[model samples]
Target: GQVEGGRKISSNTEASGRFHTDWLNMIYPRLKLARNLLHSDGVILVSCDDGEVANLRAILNDIFGEENFVAQFVWKARQFTDARANTNISTDHEYIVAYARDDGFSLKGVGRDESKFGNPDGDPRGDWMSRSMLGLATRDQRPNLHYDVVDPLTGRVFPPNASTGWRYSKDKMAELISEGKVLFPRNDDGRPREKKFRSEMRSEFIAFRSIIDGVHTADGTQEIRSLFGVDLFAFPKPTALIASLIEQVAADGDIVLDFFAGSGTTGHALLKQNAAENLKRRYVLVQLPEPLDPSNREQKVASDFCDKLGKPRTIAELTKERLRRSAARIDEENPLFKGDFGFRVFKLASSNIRAWEPVAADLESSLLKNAEHLVQGRKEQDVLYELLLKLGLDLCVPIETKSIAGKSVNSIGGGALIVCLADGLSKDVVERLASGIVTWRTALAPAVDTRVVFKDSGFADDVAKTNMAAILSQNGITDVRSL
Candidate 1:
């Protein structure tokens, strides 16, 4: 049932065997792209039920490597009593498999459990908690750490045992004692403890455990129901569960991505989390525009929603609608906690530029006619984005349009790069534009690798084209080119 709506094709492969191969074929390229998209210090958490956990792990291991496997968090997806009708056992849990880009990764802990931390002694350093100073290393393993320490306050000596040695060396112990960071008990028989101050703690990170419970499927279902007045999605993940995973690995203002964004749950959770933490975390969600089959009972409500909203009957349309309603609801409920709950939507499409392909019979005629390169009817924004891809620049960079010499120019990354594809470029306009961009470069970015690009065939004549290049080169901005 889970794989019912999958794309079908006639093949010699067995039905069950085809499923695995097809699924992996779809996922493999996406995984490769996701890895490239992530920052080097970033981590990814993927949720899956028991149905494909084994296969998923093997694929992850092959892609991210076995060493980069961070943890497998087992979440209670459903209650024990939520049994499947045909199966003898109920599937009550799911896995959140995590992997880092490399060995360099650490999760920020769930903020210190304040219930266990307090200034019991009222030490000026701050609220402190005590931990055992003894480590599991034996005296033979670390003889330097097998030392005795005298508590300055209690005048009591603590010695390392045969099985466990003192955690710190004599010099380190003395340093801790001088800083009043070591807790000395009144009873001389007690072992000396290390005081970890809330302020001085190097990192507020705890190793995320492998098992996560209590976040149930009911919460996720309730979330969708609350927004849409009905359960439009099947087995949507809990917002809290996703938020917790995100908070562990991501920092404020980091980009969160979800490719399988059913019902836009990830976006909803990000908005709620950002509102709570006063963060500017952004999200990138990708959901296929799968057409809803009204014949299927599960998607009937969603299909009806599409009709009600007067939108196309597609999953992506519903996903976007959910995000819109969720953001509006959050704003209404928490007016004071204002943060960006908005997203700019972009659809994937073929390049706006026509690829140069010579016709065998009329190669010369075709080449001359399509010299402009860009396809007809392509919007300015489309051309800009295509150029961004060609230049290896981030498509989402802040773009600002400025009128230079009466022609519109697009400045990206705060004047780090400027593009002018307007037609009919004259020598006078070219000179004025070059001077204006130089001024902008000095004021905005200043020696920050400014580059200027133009339409190759748009120049009025050879004199204008040569003048444009000479003017830019004279102004200490030689990185000029034309498409």
Candidate 2:
């Protein structure tokens, strides 16, 4: 659903717009809500094309704070040849904005692929990769970094280049020599230069730049065609492209969500990443169940293909099918990845219970029209999920729902939280709730804090609130709030 307080004003022919201040107003609340959903050490990755990149970045900087910005990744989606000849500029890349929930969030360093590291010499120190040791400093700029390199085998001193100096001082070279980190490269004339083994390198590597150009749009298109045996979608991102970002930013067992789950590409990428690295990362994908235009030729082709394959015709159906196939592929490739994909389905709908209608006909109609504002098209469970997002609680956290006094009460994290969404709470119910608090106090483990959240409309009167408060005070339950 479109978030409130934002106007969809058209600006360009392609349905783009210059968002008004209300757009920022709309985004702020969602960003704030999203921030509350993240773990203290979690991060959020937001993707945007050129249309809203600047505005999104500015909004994020304001909401998440400038210091929390991790990086803006630029993914080149198309080839240079795809550039428009008239403009002489290729608009092929999209930006993914990243921000940490807090200063504590950080990426685990990228590990070197074992296949990429190899040692030709077969030294006992294990596989190695050669890297340049050249320094940018000139002799004039850094005399301390300039020195002669002695060929350990030939005893010939190689002077520094006139323009550039050595990377280390004489004393540092001596220390490296003593530690056996430097290798003397042999030449035809029996002279040698220094070689550093990969074993001496740090276990983790630093994060790379944000620009990515290896995966092309053709790669993405080809991947979809090969996996599904048809080109059903346009401009799908390559699984590798998304995997690279996930691997760089997310950790094992982390939750990665993509609200604009176009073609289920993100889910495919997450599955592939987990299979390749033996990680246990989870994913949440959301997409509008936009209906396909059956009259269109391309849509007809897609429909026919799905019919032939005994699949459903809607976009959501196709999206789920893609995920199913991706999961199957992972399972086929590695049994360890089997049964690793599952999702809880939730669809937005009007609340199951109706609110009280006013006695007057016109007033009742108005109330019904504005019902969406007072009551959401969501259930208590849905509200709880949103609250969890707002509170930064993990989706996997255990939630127990019990029917206490004919009310569906939810307790999360082993009584750490008690939520009552029941409407029309009476004094008798409030007294029972107070008694329930005492029972919960005894049942809850020692030193574990408990909190209760109630709907403001639930209580019948102030006397009920007073009674509840007095009971909670007696039971040492201070954390309570009314929504």
Candidate 3:
């Protein structure tokens, strides 16, 4: 369900004079929560266009600390020209704002793509790569790096370029020569350079600037169209771009969450990267279940496209279908690459139980109406999920429900969450709940010091609250929260 005034207040309309302040406040809390959710070494990459990039950066600096700011990646989203537009400048790029959880967080030792390494000359050490030995500094600026490189085969020495200097000092060059890292050209006419063995290089390194080229936006679109025979999404980012970002920020087994899962492209990218690297990276994608608009021609095209591919009509349907196809492709290309594309689905809804009150003549009808309002259109399971999110619990936490004293008492995350979705929480129910805490602690084998959280509205009387608290305190339940 959408929060009505919540949106207006969050977006900060003209009615809210402190629009900028409101916007920052709205995002600040979420970021703070996100920071808590992330691992100590985790990094967050937030994608935004020019519209709010500046504001996002400033707020990120304030929230995550200026020292934790990572590189801002600039991505080219499109290649087509828009000269027909009134504005002379055509915007086709976007930014990915990156920040670390702490100063210790770094991107070093991340795996690099094997395709980037190649060996023209077969070396004993295996695939070797050549890199320029010239530094960007001018010879005049860095005289220490300016030196002559002698071709031992031709007995000739070459002077450093006037514009650029050698990358190493004379002593360092001599050390590299003794170590056999410097490669003299076979022709004896070309400049000498340094050789980097693939085996010697670190598997991971810091990510470069965000400006990505070479991979076309059309490449992603074509990949989807090739599988489905028509554009499944308006614009999808190339797998390479997403893979690069993932490799730089995410660890092998970390869970990546994408709440704005448009067309499920991020899932596909994650799966592809994991398969290629033999890493097990799990992904959770959340998308609004927006229905297809039949009257729109674009919708018609998508519908016909799905028909052509012998698939379902809706976007979510096609998203799963594409994931299956990608998994199949990975399996075909590399038998060793095991692809996992399974996911559990969930939907949000309201609470299941009602706040109890006495059924007196003045309150009877209101109590009945409120009970109906609580459980009429929503399921108990959906309410439980909503509470979990509201309580800042991980979505993947396990939940177990059992009938206790004719009421559904849910033990979530091993009794960290104790919920009762019953019509009226009576004195007997509270007593049972208090006893169940001990049962759950034993069942889950958690430390005797486990916390318990209950719905504030579940208590029927002051005695029930006192008994529950006293029982919990006796059992060493030191932490408790209500919602």
Q: Who is ahead in lDDT, 1 or 2?
A: 1
In candidate 1, position 386 carries an lDDT of: 81
Tell me the tens digit of each residue's lDDT in model 1 across 274-326.
88788888899998777898889988988998999999999999899989998
- Residue 221 shift from truth in candidate 1, angstroms: 2.1
- Among all candidates shown, the one with the greatest TM-score: 1
Q: Which 10 residues in a row give candidate 3 its minimum summed lDDT?
A: 1-10
Native RMSD of candidate 2 (Å): 7.3
How many angstroms is residue 360 displaced in model 2 relative to the true structure, after the best TM-score fit? Answer: 11
Model 2's alpha-carbon lDDT is 0.74
lDDT of 2 by residue, 1-483 (tens): 552344222213343353445455555676777888788888888877887788899889887899999888898877766544677766888888899989866666656556656778777877766544456788789887777777676676766766667667779878876765566665544322345556666665756667888898789889889888889888888899889888877788888887668789899999999988889898888776665666888687667766877766767777888898888877888886543766666666654444666657588687767544435555677777766666687666778777767777887888877788887678898878678756865686535778887777678888887777778877888888876
Ranking by TM-score: 1, 2, 3
TM-score of each: 0.75, 0.66, 0.66
Residue by residue across 1-483, what tens digits does model 3's lDDT show?
A: 434553434556757778568767767777777788788888888888786789999989988999999878888877786677688887778888889988877664444566766777766778766777877788678989888887655667878877888888999988887777788877645777888787887555535655876666788899888877777577777777787778666778888777557767778888888887899888877665554555777687777666766755667666667777877777687787764656667755434655666667768677657744445577667777777777788777777878766677787777666776555666787778778766767687754356565556567766777777888788877676655
Candidate 3 lDDT score relative to the true structure: 0.73
